[model samples]
Target: MDGDIYKIVEQPLSPDAVAASVGDPAAGGVVIFSGIVRNEKDGRPVKYLEYEAHAAMAEAKMREIGAAVRQRWPSVKAVTMLHRIGRLEIGESSVLIAVSAAHRREAFEACQYAIDTLKQRVPVWKKEHFEDGEVWVGLQGG
Candidate 1:
């Protein structure tokens, strides 16, 4: 509740901005994770990607993740999670997560938890577009 940032937006997410949002004076370390769109998947050339989600519910789920992080790692000072929706080209970030804590280990672990939980629990859908065809996949994989 103190320092948690969660959002779902159509615009591109900036790693610097997400990290800045989680910056804290008491925090000794901050870890950021960016999930970007790659050029290929399963040996198939990917043209682009499109993401969609129930924005409000997605943000609420992110807040829940932050709460879980704080509960699991009390040292965590701040958390920020942003997921970008809509058409994204190769190399564009689809998700960004940042965590700040009293130590590097907690920050790293908390960031990992936030991302993994997000993929598993958040109701976001992903569409992979290829030159040949397109496929819809759940956020848990593909």
Candidate 2:
């Protein structure tokens, strides 16, 4: 794709769907990683999470990551990234990254890099709701 294939949705995401979307026979290796909302954060209970995003800017940024992966690893066949918005309960996946490549190494690296960079640079915001209170998390990697 020439433009952003990355999607940030407000509804629940399906990992199998995302994985199937990027599956290619030419690619011998496929790697998928999910960033889940755990029941606890730093030993504290977490009720739910709400994600917000600057749709246009966030998507543009994700496309940049995918393009960069393609450029860095020519063996990579495809890349797909999905992040969830709105209220999410604990144990739900908030983000998913899938990559296919000729070898396992490239797929793993590209997938990891995509998620890491997306968290640092993307215009998405997350609010954590706890029993006591709620707080927005950014650039913290928590």
Which candidate wins on lDDT?
A: 1
Name the regions of candidate 2 deviating beyond 4 angstroms. Answer: 2-4, 139-142
Candidate 2 on 1-142: residue-level lDDT in tens?
4422598888788888877878778889889999999898899899999999998888889999999999999898888888888899988999988998999999999999999999899998989899999888854577
**Per-residue lDDT over 1-142 for candidate 1, one digit per residue giving the tens place of the 0 to 100 score:** 5668899999989999988998889999999999999999989999999999999999999999999999999999999999999999999999999999999999999999999999999889999999989999754373
Superposed by TM-score, candidate 2 places the C-alpha of residue 128 at a distance from the truth, in angstroms, of 0.9
TM-score of 2: 0.93
Pick by TM-score: which candidate is best? Answer: 1
Against the hidden true structure, what lDDT does model 2 obtain? 0.87
lDDT of 2 at 51: 92
Quote the positional error of residue 85 for candidate 2 in Å: 0.6
Q: Residue 80's C-alpha lDDT in candidate 1?
A: 92
In order, the Cα lDDT scores of the candidates are 0.93, 0.87
